[model samples]
Target chain A: MTDAVSARERILARVRAAVANAPEAAAVARDYRTSHTADDPAAVLGLLHENLADYRAHVHRTAPDGLAALVAERLAERGARSVAVPPGLPDAWLAATDAVRRPDEPRLSPYALDGIDAVVTGCALAIAETGTIVLDGGPGQGRRALTLVPDLHVCVVLAPEQVVASVPLALPRLDPGRPLTWISGPSATSDIELDRVEGVHGPRTLEVILVTGG
Target chain B: MGMPSFPEAAREAVGDTTLRANLRHATHTIRDKRARAVAELDDWAALREAGKRIKDDTLRHLDTYLVRLEAAVTAAGGTVHWAADAAEANRIVTALVRATGETEVVKVKSMATQEIGLNEHLEAEGIAAYETDLAELIVQLGEDRPSHILVPAIHRNRAEIRDIFAEKMGSWGRPAPDGLSDTPAELAEAARLHLREKFLRAKVGISGANFMVAETGTLVVVESEGNGRMCLTLPETLISVVGIEKVVPSWRDLEVFLQTLPRSSTAERMNPYTSMWTGTTDEDGPSAFHLVLLDNGRTDALADEVGRQALRCIRCSACLNVCPVYERAGGHAYGSVYPGPIGAILTPQLRGTSSEIDASLPYASSLCGACYEVCPVAIDIPEVLVHLRERVAEEGGKGHRLEKAAIKAASWVLDRPNTLAAVERLASATRKVHPKRLPGPGARQWSDHRDLPELPAEPFRDWWRKNRP
Candidate 1:
């Protein structure tokens, strides 16, 4: 099976090469400038907060020590009985919370995940410019579905990891062969009449926990 | 089924007043909302410029980005398959499904799947591919091809949709409740109940991503309905078929697109559901994940220096909404899975300007610039249309031959002053005996809808000499 797959891959590679070389449209160059300072992480975090708020995502901040407690308290305030945690989530982060902990399991179905009140996971990276959080199915990220099926999701971001950059700079960090999810904010839509509706596909509520001053 | 001639299919759509009304209303509503939503952002122009630049740069450095993306995804424990065309893509997906031993799959709304005719091919293999999007479900139940890009069932009104539900909902599973009304809530409820059953029972899911981040090896899908979320997460084995061009340079790059796509497409500030996934995880979601990066005609599209701009399209359908011809003629007229201005240029380029319908598509538009103004990527659709018209004329032997003959005859007569004067004299002398309409074997039908200009007492040149010269 691997051999056949390789053969098919080889054929497709040749086809792509041919298509790429075909004479068609000329490329148009676009010019745009950005005013982001990459040197300062705080500046990046500030941009992230601004963008997140712009997208209507709720933002909260705390020192590393108070991070988990804040998340737990927020969940409790929302009346969440159980919160879904990714496999690699830090145990210390949830130590302050008395809420029922539901670790994300492979066998858990969509129906099962739907039963969870909320989900919490650490992000692979956060882009401040666009107010986007990226999960690369990493340790605490779990599968894409777990984050998507639940109504509420709490994404934890370490301040230093935030990048105040363009897409070209971020591309080198991602793996093309893995399942990677990029989230801007909570799911939302507008009807034909332009009435905005939130939480149609993934989480209806998104709370970003930016742990700063480590 | 093989694609039929687009003009004939379009002729039928054009005649259907109800379908036209539905499409006009739906498209206009979305278009207006998008304008308003886009207006709320002061940096929208800058964002659009950034999105366009990123896409262009990515396409330019696609080889590097794709390699980087593949390495990242593989490193993260995901499998990636490259498919050259529709047949290859379908074969890969079918094999993946077969390996999972799943005969039925639930699908999110994916234009890539439609472009490749994935459902029909899967059905041929005795695999049932259920469309989970409400609009897509209507199209599948009605056994019809989608007319609109975003709203696949835009041609259908509430009443027609209710009838489709009444007749076809039961056979698929989860019959519509008795005495279903055409109200939006009831219709949504019926579809919700129907899809929930499929989401639970299906073991495999198929989807297409709006963007694939090369940096993180992540795939993203933006949808309004929760169905896409269900399809992405519910199944144990998930397969995503994406056009190779869907790739972006990085996660940060996605921000620019997320802002522009929703407003340009559904005319919203944000999509209701934006789902992203990278690779498989040990204890969450689908155990096995497969990414099928399909080139199909995109590489061909990319190769064209003038035509490659079409690749910049986010498939927002903004161009379709503002197009005057599309408003009256509907989507089916352009043919292929893609329709309107984008389809006119894209389908022909992908398939080649060989077929009669494809050749005709270049001429379908009125060369209006509306499509360009509304295009988020700023594709000069009219410019492309004219460019394609030249290509068609060059390739269309019969049309070229007749045009050449007509031009040669006109040149011979005009080149000589005596010949022109004599002809004018002869025409005027015979004016009284001339037919009230155009003469000749080929011109009878042409003059039916038009009046033959009254013959001047003297020719224009003759009058000019007598009056002015």
Candidate 2:
């Protein structure tokens, strides 16, 4: 056997011997509240908006029909010359935008992605209690870099459908096999004198559009 | 030179006015914010209980969960390596980096790596390891030891950091901007520009995990700045060296910690970024992933029943913030990567009490019980400190022998009532002529910092008998 294999065996033996006379651990009691917020959908959506803004993410609410125009307006407001479009994003979402479209057909290199001015993608889910949005690299959500590299990220979250009330409720809905990124706000750091300063490395500007009605 | 005891080390720190002010400002700011954040959760007590229980369960069956975790990570196309101690772990990582023919690697700020001294070891073998997190970057550039767990350079103020960056950044890779100011925002921008070049060109990345799930084989990194994401996502070959006790039994266990850790560490609703990945992803992140399970001295700690709960720490640094002793003495006084209340108990167990520093660590606290109250896992640090003190005393040294002899003499006198009464009467008669301080080696040292209590005018037994009769 190799050295690594022998080491593994020895470590395991030590662990077993260490706990041989130990008493059984008490069963984990999970009586903690699953959702701190009420069960109403409007309340959950409202909480999500308040939290996202609390972390300095600019938030806006709009109807599904107004999303394309809203997306175009956000991009133009940021003065973005180019926007990276993730695979399977609805074609009409960018119909009204005149900015050059950079799709992830052949995945963009890190260097190339850095040059893009903005990225617009959909999310897998959003947690209200924590004000978090999780991206699983599914349909509208591209690879992690699509949202990470660009200076600006315009994330579209379909409300009432994709929003959850708490973290416990957010876990089971996520698939463990896929790569996940849970973003609460734009990149920030509290390293200097323990004072928080936003916009470090990840998308410095996070614009979230909560689409209320399909 | 031998390392000084905790008192010797703490005395110097207490005298430094600048360090005392820095610790006071930083710790006080976070303490208030953490209390408010925790108060928002009505069921915080239940969550803390569940977190403690889940970790207990995981440690109880660590062998089973580890084996299962290895299998799951393997099935997901990642290779698992086991390291029995720090030397072997360093050897494995060095060889892995050498295999890729890369002399440089980007790193996320991880306590496990700090515990093993990975960067120093790698540097000895001709590799350059760059720390990406903003606080870690400050420490690395300044060539200073980490004081706080979450914020390694908490000892530094804004001016000190700006000086370190301006003076050292050029030699590392990118230089700080000309005429750089001391503002936190400008300083952070300097780090972003410096690390971005390394991230874009890096072939290998090294990290440590906050949590590793046994059932799904997923690893989690909870971080504040975007630096963690850059290193974890940009590199081609990602290597994570995590302690053996980091594994949880299942994925659902994260719900408890996700709520508690953010509030406890940085006092935030949720940190800016958290990355979760299982093994390797095709064309998404790293193509090849390596998970190193490090044991160093954890199994030895596990063998000790009272000392084992130190393994449940999430490295939140909350205990360090509220500790009165830590506030005055600072993190460097603890003399290890782990510091404050957690370090006082943990360093002794992991490193053993043979050395002077380790022996003195258990006595570092005043037994105020602040650390116990703030601990998320509720490890009674004072209980473990007293238990370790018993073990230290039993080892039989000069001071302990004197203590034992003194205790024996007191017990003997108390057992004989007549002799005790005679002694009490003599003490009362000589009270005016008695010396202010006890004249002895051990007793003199004890009385140096504390006032000698005055002898009572009369013994309690005599007063009680006369009054009652």
Candidate 3:
């Protein structure tokens, strides 16, 4: 069997030879709009709320002080017995919740996390145009598994500050080194006769809390 | 070992009424939804143009970008292995799985892996590979080939899918619950339960990336189901077999595709999940990451300036949905893992026009240009089809033998106006007695589905002379 080192050299040589006589392609013209909607923060916030709900995510709004109560209420409504909390999640965020808090210092195993009822975490950012919430394994957002294994994901997006108008605006602000998961709605599949069916492998129910006015 | 020609395969598929009904319902539903989704953006034209340019630029300097990507992935603590062909890629992956001492692997739906036939290769090596996506799971359970790029089981309706699950799930791992129904929700739930056990225990995971950012060494997988997340995050070792053409120059280049891909594919503003990870991180996700760069027939494809534009495809399957021929003939007729308009052009170029299926693929289209219109990257599929048709003609394949004969016969008759007129009059006189279909081997296949045109009572010249005089 040919080794990898020679394989690399041969493949690159073939690629160079393939395009040797080809015309030089023109430079990319990026005249596309950075944001589809208006620049106003309030309008962007409203679009985020509208689009997220359009994909069937439950959307709510609360003040900074009312956040703990809203989180607790959503978890209680799901009847969650335990919630996986990321390491840097604020204590005040889950203070009012009656569900047991399973911290991730030791890092929950896939089986252990499977048994947990829900996961609550903060986000790196959210895109208004696409209705996507991005988690980059940040302080409050645990590893990728934390949000994946649980049936219910209650993600808190700090409005205006954590929200952007479009995908183009969202990429530069993110760090590429960390693992990123961009979720628009709860897990969905159009596999069955091309009809949209929500609740597949990821969180079946995604509840977004847009906390405003600290 | 000659495969049936495209016309032969398509004729068999077109005759299946159940398959036609399943395809029509699925394609029509997604076509309208995709149109509405794309209509929401005002600068869609500009985005399409930009997407085309970015892909073109990447292809032109693919060697440099690939080298840069290798350096970045290695710098970020990921091992990069290069494969010149399918056999080498299979060997590399089999060795990786063997080194880990794992007999089973969970797979996310990937066209590259399907192209390489990775599952069968591993199974031959005494390893069991489980497909995790809901659509892929259905195809695997049914012992069928993928019919669509996005929804592999598009040909299987709800009832067929439920039946496949009810019968086949047990032998694979988990059994479907008693009394399975035809509803989409219940079937999806059954898949979720059946795969959850494998997700939690698998030691090795395999996948293909939608886009690999050369700048940051980040591999991105865009998917709707959470099965992708499970196969990606839970496994201790992750192996991604990516085509060499899947590279982009910068991290920010994802903006264009991140916006256009979802709308074109699933007709959603965004898919439910899009995962991007650069190599491996400490105590997060996979502990060991391997990036296998595959160039199986890709370098050959890049040689043709006109055909190389096919490499720009993002695998949106929009072309498949809009194509009229694809609507009736179905995807399996394309005789490739890639199906539809994109496949017609792509398969022939990658594999060449030597085989019967590959030669016939170039002629599969009516060239209505719907695939070109719906293409997000603006691949101009018709131009490639025509180009490949020329190659097929030059290469001298079986399908074109009758084509050349007919053209020769036509020129001979047209050389003499007297013979042409006499022949026309003869055809006119025999109009009632003329057969609906032609006779002979290749000619019969052509006339089987098409009716010969109704002949006029007299030639046009006779009518012109009689009236004018």
Best by TM-score: 2
True contacts kept of 3: 0.88
Please report, in order, the local distance difference test score of every candidate based on alpha carbons.
0.77, 0.92, 0.94
**What is every candidate's C-alpha DockQ against the true complex, given to 2 decimals?**
0.21, 0.85, 0.88
lDDT for model 2? 0.92
**What is the lDDT, from 0 to 100, of the residue A37 in candidate 3?**
93
The number of the candidate with the highest lDDT is 3
Candidate 2 C-alpha lDDT tens digits along A30-65: 999998999999999999999999999999999999
How does model 3 fare in lDDT? 0.94
What is the TM-score of each predicted model, taking all chains together?
0.76, 0.95, 0.93
Candidate 3: give the clashing pairs. none
lDDT (C-alpha) at residue B370 in model 1: 87
How high is the lDDT of residue A195 in model 2? 89
Order of candidates by DockQ, top first?
3, 2, 1
Decide which is better by DockQ, 1 or 3.
3
**Each prediction's number of clashing residue pairs:** 32, 0, 0
